[model samples]
Target: MLDAGLPVRAFFTDRRGGHSAAPYDTLNVALHVDDDPDAVAHNRVVVSEAAGALVTFLEADHGITVARIDEPTPRPPKADVLLTTTPGIALAAIAADCVPLLLNDPQTGAVAAVHSGREGLYRGVVDSAIAAMLDLRPSGAGAAGIRAAIGPAICGACYEVPENLRARVGRRHPVAVASTSWGTPSLDIPRAIETRLTELGVGPVLRHRHCTFEDTRWFSHRRDARTGRHAGVIVCEGPVGVSVPAPEDAAT
Candidate 1:
């Protein structure tokens, strides 16, 4: 787990640590990937156990909707952004090649996990999330004090897209406009995301350089269709107590 540099605890999950088998091999936290439901449950338990907090993971639809988690629940909502100020609960966003963003405001101790895919980014997921985050803060709060982490995802060189699609996204996000290694039009999502964060006044942004499509340690749907998904999780310290067997016990 790489440190997110936020005031709260944060980390990005990879493919090496769960009970899933084959393409979803291990550490697949997503419930809709057609993996064994039992295995997914075990995986979620393991993740929550390790954090000593209740886990609330978003079921992303690649849209800009938001879900507010005041406490841990049996079912997390379907949204692109999950936010909570409650302590002792974790907020997570699952993804394979799409970007999983962990955001936190140290001053307010409010944290959020966001799913920023190409469509969501094009449709303003980042802006929506930041707006919601600010709403949770004081009257004058902005994103200047928010700490953010960008997890592994398909790189620009590997995310080839049609010209019109690139143009559509580029018209708003010029930094997203990119060319693949072989010279086809592509979208450098991570880079574009970092640029957006910088533009938003968020500082000291932490970004992982791993490309999901190029790194076997990370599950990549573009590289291996029907593959599993990993997640970006943020656990805040609070009063709730939740526990279960550790991941090692379930992964085997």
Candidate 2:
């Protein structure tokens, strides 16, 4: 597990130590990847144990949709961003190469887990998540206390893209436009996310240096097509199941 360097109990999981077979390997938490269902269940239980609470792993739609979790449930709603203020209810964002971002506001004890891919980034999923978190803030509260953790992902040096594709994403997030080590067009998604967080006044952003594509310790879908997915989990630890009024748009 990769520590997120925040006050809350937040960390990103690596693909190690669990009950899965080859391809999916061990510790694959994503059930949709065709891994053994019983094994996936066991792996999820392992992750929850690591989290010290039951984790609500998000199901990504690869969009900017946001959902608020008020209580633990058997099935989590499908959304790119999952927000929670209830204490002891952990939220997780599952990904391989895509960026798994965790956010927390010390002022309100609100936290979010975001699954941001190329499309989600281009479509402003990061902004959506921050907005959702801000919406959870009390009246007149500001965003100065919000902190972020960017987990392992495909770095710019390895995330090669077409020139046109790079141009397309660069139009909005210019910092994301980059060149791979081999001198080809690429996108630095993690760096771009850091920049966005800074722009949104989120301080002390901690970004994990490990690149999933280059590091064998973490699972990379680009490196292995049928690979398993890991997660970035953040725990909320104040109260439990207290319903904070959510914006209408937060519904999944």
Candidate 3:
């Protein structure tokens, strides 16, 4: 588990220490990836155990929808962002190449786990999550003290896209416009998210510099289509069903 460098019990998982067989190969936390159901269940329990709470996993749709999780449930809702002010409820965002972003508000003690990929970013998933988090704050409690952890993702150095697609996203997020190491049009999603957060005043972001496409430790769909998924998890500690940040997933 990669600690998000936050005071909370938050971390990103690697493709190690799991029960799933090859392809899904160990520690695969996703239930819809055509992996063995029994293996997926075991992996989920393992992750939840590591989190020290039953986690509510988001079934991402690559949209800006947000869901509030106050308690554990048999079925997690479908959304790109998950928000909670409750403790003892760990939230997880599963990913392969897209960005897994975690947020925590020190003052209001609210937390948000956002799933933002190229499509979601274009659709404003990050903005939706930030807006939702601000709503959870106390009266007049603004975005100050709101911290973020940007988990590993495909860096611009390797993420190549079509010229038109790159131009489209670049129009909205100029910082995202980039050229890959191979001189192809690319989008640096994590960097763009960081810039957006800073512009919105939700700062002090702790970025995990390991690129999923370059690193073999984490899963990367772009590297292998039939690969397993890893996760970024955060659980509340202040009170049960009460406070902290959480996680969600995004499709590539």
Q: Judged by lDDT, which candidate is best?
A: 2
lDDT scores in order: 0.82, 0.88, 0.85
Per-model TM values vs. the true structure? 0.91, 0.93, 0.92
Tell me the tens digit of each residue's lDDT in model 2 across 1-252: 888876789999998988999988788989899999999999999989999999999999999999999986648888999999898889999999999999888767888999998999999999999999889776666566677889999999999999999999999999999999999999999989988888886666778889999998888999999989999999997532323332431211
Please state the error at residue 111 of candidate 3 in Å. Answer: 1.3
The ten-residue window of minimal lDDT in model 3 covers: 243-252
Question: Of 1 and 3, which scores higher on lDDT?
Answer: 3
Candidate 3 residue spans exceeding 4 A from truth: 239-252
Query: How do the residues 158-195 of candidate 3 rate in per-residue lDDT, one tens digit apiece?
Result: 99999999999999999999999999999999999988
Collision count for each candidate, in order: 2, 1, 7
